[model samples]
Target chain A: MLPYGLVTIEDRVARLLTELPPNPQFPTQGATLFVDLARRQVRQAYTPRRIIETFLAGRGANMFYLYRLLDESLDPIDPSVPLIFGSGVLTGIVPSAARGNATSWSPESGVLMDSNAGDYFPSFLKMNGIDHLVIYGRADAWTVLWLGDGQVEFRDATPYLGLDNIDMRDRIATDLGGTWTRDLAMANITRAGENQVLTSAIMAGPKACYARGGPGAKMGSLKMKAIVVQGQTHDFETAQPYKQYNKEIATKLLNTSVVKNALRTMGTPFLYRPSRVLGAMGTKNNQETTWTDRLDAENITPYRPGMAGCFRCPVNCRPLNQLNDDQADRYGRGDGPEYVTLGKFGPNVGIDQVEPVIRLNNICNDLGLDTASTGSAIAWAMELYQRGIVSKSDTGGLELTWGDAELVERLLFAMSHREGFGNVLADSTRAIERGHYPTEARKYCMAVKGLMQSDPHDARILKAFALGLAVSTRGMDHLRNRVTLEINARINDDPGFKAKLYGGPVSAQPNNYETKERAVRVCENIYGVGDAVGMCRFTTKLFNSPSLPGLEEFSSQIANVTGLEFDADVLDRIGLNIMGVERLINHRLGVRRSDDTLPDRWFDEEITVGAYKTEKIDRQEFDAMLSRFYAISGLSDEGVPAEAWRQELELVLSGPA
Target chain B: MSITVRLPTTLQTSGQDSLTITEPVENIAELVRVLRRQLPGFPAQWDDSMLNFSVNDEVVLHRAEERVLASGDVVEIILALSGGTPVPRSAC
Candidate 1:
């Protein structure tokens, strides 16, 4: 009785077939998949050209789609909450364009949110001729959605239940295709998601994940376990222009020494050396700001298996590591121990040893827990214990001590399973702030708007970074609005260049408060565009490298790949519009000017050690900066988008629900 | 003035992370000059503009020549790249 003509071999399984109408503008020709698991209904329809044109792809598309799906009546944790998957238009066709986005209402933040990942999943999604996938409604039983050969299959995921992400992917691939399935990609969750932990991540490919904003919890709420994709590859190399363009980009990436020597050779651990010396990282749960080099990248080189990249990426910045040490050997091999992981599990918890950090990262990856949040949660508890706020009696007879790697690992598992004291950690900082010691412990928890400020870097001195983190829609995320160039002394000293870039004199000094709002605004715009297009920030100009691609390159690539005439200004506007849309969604969720603020510790506590010792956010300066940012972002003094912004965003949101 | 000069792994050639510059250097520019003279393997192409000189954890962001250094100062010379280790910016 399905409208699209369902075919059923068994009463439990259902399939819907539909024809795609050709649209010259869309590369996918408006291919969209809609699945309602509660009703066991599936439908395929042409995505409106207006939606594609206005939103573009990836997060840009998600912003509009998520906004439309979200209503005042819809609870953030409702089982019917829409989970969206989208890819950039240029994905699979261009280098460094393989990143994908998953959008849903964050159960933790109580707001619409999206997290991105880089891997074969996005490429396979695009190659399989599906540009956008939307799944909603709770299934009667655990289900896995298989996308391949221009069709979708609903497979019972009961057998895959309770399996880790890696196991689930391997088993699903073997069951659906084979051991050597070609071009098969999988995104799955683990025990953490099954337990509905707020910090769970959707593991894409082997290591990449849409980790932020708790997208895995949304997937779990729908009784979904994994999504498997197998698609035919497109040979754009046959086209001479496309081939030459890809070569040009690949050559540029290789030519950049940062990419070749530092990023590719050492991966994200390359930042460890700088962060250690510069005192950029938060140590011991923001109580300290410096750590020794025991956890340096050079120490990790021995265990690194090899470098891996997403789809057509040339940078290959991820190191697929194999732990060699006796303690870490049991966790087995996995990707990452990214810089954030190094800081979060290492210095943040006072664990200087490299192996323990790797073990912690691997455990999080295996259990589908976010290392940032997990580390933060444990660090918060340790600090609470240190301050004598909590004791062994309250912790189920477990002493929360700093540098206790064994306890950290055990707590990660406990948090995943919501066991004992780990249940408190799994509920996020807000729950603890309100439920536990509201006054004494709240000051110690470094969270903004319920989401833990995951970046291990202390932002007290990094004024632009602090401002960016404060105003980020998803709450306290670095990638959204970090003006990395603020720390580059060479760039900062060049007044003319700075003025041209930011439209004003933005200081290069990390502690300077003047003109930072301008820099933050510009960075917000660039990141908006970057996220929309699914470009990894590391591969873009945002990463303090002039050689990497930015708006100009993206504009040209979009033209070459999609035949769309989206100039840099248009892209900038689209990014800006996406920001406005996100703010509007949050506004509807009761977010106000008060919500656009940082943690109390950022302003109250001074960094004990570092080059920027005694540095903290000046309340007046931060307030002024926030006001300026709002003014420039076309928002009212109260943090609401002005009428002009509303009209412009409404124009984009006006087309086809 | 005996100053401690710490070099990043990428810049080190003497198989050491740090060296003692016993020579008197008034500012970061002079310190760089002394470094180039003392360390034979120091890249001659590097200039004050290319490096971030942090004196006792305080970064000399503008006009390194004007920022005065004192005896017993710990000078950490890192690359201008904010997110990564020291590398020649010209290669980009």
Candidate 2:
């Protein structure tokens, strides 16, 4: 039974839902959906006049966009319990919108975790008249939740249970709605999630995924199949501010020569060759960082069908990779095999072939598993096998050898089904746990705070990236700020810009440990702001160092979209607040200075590649750098936020659950 | 002292990691001209607009001919491996 006496705000188009305080302690605004089997309701009660103060702009985007700011009120959102989803103020409207967080308490790390994915659902959701959906309690049986024209419906989903993503998509479309004719999207769960696999992702679409923590399993536990969002791209005249704002990015992406050609032509797979040259890829689970010969555009091109884009995005960086007979025999074709997939499965796992790598990628999508974690885990297992720590007996009678694609496929299948050895690889944190390994295997695991490392860019080569990987709030993610100033130090900026932005040298060489702390601090702040505002880092030149969307333009985008006053300074403060608040959340979750360090491999082992040879995070220097960053972040010596800073961000206060 | 000029993956000569100029070259222009006569397809994969030269590790933004190179200097034709070719940062 749904909670009775639920204050309803059925504006229909712009619904604001709130959970009734079981204890009347925590006052939550930004739409938190609470669902039960019997009925679905939107509760926008407890409208304190002071709640308007909480409204940064229109319930901080009608209690949608700036929802993550409501994190303090909505802490301990058990990912094992409620399957929650929320959007940003300008999610569906902006052309560069690639983010909207799926906030939940991680079953893997037992911390607050949010997984971000791009396109489709976020945009059309607005037109259909829904901000966000938060599911509470369990459904009686297998169910499908559909949202259309401001109405929520639940149908029997017993028939579609245990189906793969591709087949599931077609079946879901037929059952829930019609074809992909409308701009409809859903967060689809899989068998991996149903079985409580920690690494399972809620499939965002066929290609992309809201992957990180086990959101799928959370949905599966609820006996829910998919949250079908039926919405359309609204007309231009209805919201002139939105139209003008969308045009700002759409026009730039269409006309600008800055980001054209490369992404469109080769997509992200083009990075393979250069990364090989620099010897910067994490090859064979970081035992080696470079590949002598690996798949690049030349080999991967033969499989490319065309370009793939997110909802209304023109700078589509995904290649629709098709499979041949032998390749198709193992697994059918899919949209990506993105750079992350390529890196994780290709060089990282020791497979140089593009076809099998692509197939492995498809299998990840189909099974609704995170390719980054799954592939990295497989690579880690392969290394263990080589060391004789893992044998055929433990591997379920298959050899865990490097560059073995067939074995990779078999292992992924097992992982999805949570069968045999796959169960061990499912939870990264468990593997990191002492004595969880067959032998002394915890040291070999390349993860930060239980979450798997992203992008596979060897941190040994890029120092700032290493810092970010060490200290990222969520986990080891590159999107926190794709630190490329080190890569393009000379080509990008001046002493003025550098000093103004990061208070560092203009030609801040990638090798120099100096000035990196400042650089990383600035990058994280901006990226946090981008994440908060639901801005896509790729399309907009946010942290790509001196690129597009300068301060004035950034603020104008916010003001234009929401009719709120924002600028570079305000954005900086917002980012700082988010980071500070995130610190408090982690503080509550037991993450401290001790957890804010890199893997042993990064500190002990030198990068055995030319140009970056004899490079590793010097422990003494890194320790001091972390201290400097803490000071800059207004945190105490122990990486805890100052009491004053927490109060300023309203994090010191709390509400009841 | 003679120097070797190296190229990235896109511009490197087949089966060669670098091109060594034992003959004396005065500047970048002289090096480019000599390389054109010396190597096949020297300018085929290059565009004047796209090529940003790095003498040693420092970026050479303008007047490549004026930026003289003596012996033991490594000249690298800078181009992004993926896509970001070095566009000039406006003279400050």
Candidate 3:
């Protein structure tokens, strides 16, 4: 009894039988695409009885698709396996920030990780008369997939291969023969992908990037050169129901003055000071708990003109600034030394000057290198040099001195080209730890689960964030569980209000041990939903929009979008399902609770300078928080989500959680 | 005879985007009081405990009580937390 004009299974099967090639990749069994008349296209469709049911059902569907695509091998550890990008029912149609998600086997953490970008992809796909694109297997040569209006063409882009992101973008625009507009089309990857850098990211829009887990490298490994999507319009279908929903949410979001103010003014960079002040900004290879006063003074003083932002984003946090006269002459303009870049490249490398950090950020961006990983690797090298494990002879006579801009520039170039010492540094701190200087390298490698830390938020003042990073599928990422709200609340002048929001007394602060478990759990669950839908966490986290919805609201959005009567409980189950499947993926990969831990220095050393001096996160408290987090997440004592949780998610038994 | 009182980045817009202005004051406290008269909301944004007034790059943390202001001292009232919060007025 579905809508009559909707593409039915019979119709699609008939079309496929006639039109599909002998080597088509669609799974013949265990999955079916349905044409919901209301939706007007063929898509993987399911109806769950409750929130838990939907979660389990959706995750089961995705896992089944993943396994079938991988030739029925259920090993998550297999690097050759394809990454399945899935969106929850509410994804594109939802008025809130909840939008799109990317699910892949993470090379960094060696587990299935889900990360969210912005809403552009989901909305575009929906508008294009498609639900999802299941990318399977590696390509044989450097190729670009152009999904234009009503046609998808695969072109050989070997000529543009080995180019950096900025150049690649320019080349694509020139070849495509149009002025590229930011009206929700897709393009990503560069020569960094060609190099197969594990931390390399695909840049989209001007600043929006599919940053985590080397999607670019994955594309490069497949011999896929680039993906150019065009003809996608920004306008959504304005049905009566859609109009009503958009109006209500838009009115609510615009009405909230504080939310609007915070986003429109400071953007995500506001966290820089708070994180630094609270001793959370990772510094000196995560060895330094707080940045020096001089470092802060140099970085934050410049009054730059003009603001930049992602497509359709109201908060223009990206600052286009001029550093020194030389830099202005070179790059012409610089794209932000944003919080992560500033903290990672500046204080982490022991550089106190803002201009150098700005230059370093621009170089990394232009070279298509991840600043966080790049900075951490360089910091490790510096530490090794200082400790005599690495000498001037090792560095080719270049002094790895703190606050030296010239040394930083040389090292960055060396790392990019994999030249001399840069070859060793290019492999990341984790790889370096396994190399000859294990003891010295291990002391400075500031990463959890192989991925380097992002943000300068001190783990001591922000224990929940530390715990989240420890347990994140992609190693030490801030997005998995951004505990900024809890930290901000605890640090506010109003102790009673802070206690009310975070659930504790002033002295027994949530920033301390007592409340970290619950805090992380809430953040993870909300973020998990965001990831499943592929929404940007910045819009959700900073804007304080109704992105982190409870089960009922999630269901309502899905119901509104697809015209499916999904229950509220079904939405909650979807989150549980995604987490459970990811845990199983990690388990299959041999990841255990021991893998979920912070570097030793975070526990042993106290912050020596800045506002929160002498503060250190306690190891016992961190462990206790992990235990509680696992229990609440329906995971085992070993930090694996339980079988019952898996069953609740309705995923087929592939392996242990 | 008066000394020039320098404004912080946040309040620079109100003083016609000028960094320094001639103000009739004998001490730092008097200068602050004069600044408050000129700018109504200046004192509320500052914390006295953390406030460190400077004169030509020198810390005058305790100089409000002991040191008398000279005609051309180049007094600067620097807020420790200027960059931390979003300033309402434009730095333009």
Name the best candidate (by TM-score): 1
- List the candidates ranked by lDDT, beginning with the highest: 1, 2, 3
Per-prediction fnat: 0.25, 0.05, 0.00
Per-model C-alpha RMSD: 4.8, 6.3, 9.3
| Residue A97 C-alpha lDDT in model 1 | 77
The CAPRI quality class of candidate 1 comes to acceptable
Kindly list the per-residue Cα lDDT of model 3 for residues A367-476, writing each as its tens digit: 66677777877887787787888888877887888667788888777766667777676667446544735565676677777777765565765566678778876677
TM-score of chain B of 1: 0.77
Scored by lDDT, model 3 comes in at: 0.55
Best by DockQ: 1
Weakest lDDT window of 10 consecutive positions for candidate 3 chain A: A23-32
Docking class of 2: incorrect
Model 1 TM-score (2 dp): 0.91
Q: Cα miss at A401, model 3 (Å)?
A: 2.3
Candidate 1 per-residue C-alpha lDDT over A540-559 given as tens digits, one digit per residue, 9 for 90 to 100: 76565655777888888776
- Worst-scoring 10-residue span by lDDT in model 1 chain A: A9-18
lDDT (10s digit) by residue, model 1, range B5-24 = 88766567768889999888
Local distance difference test, per candidate? 0.75, 0.64, 0.55
Candidate 2 accuracy as TM-score: 0.83
Please tell me what DockQ candidate 3 reaches: 0.05
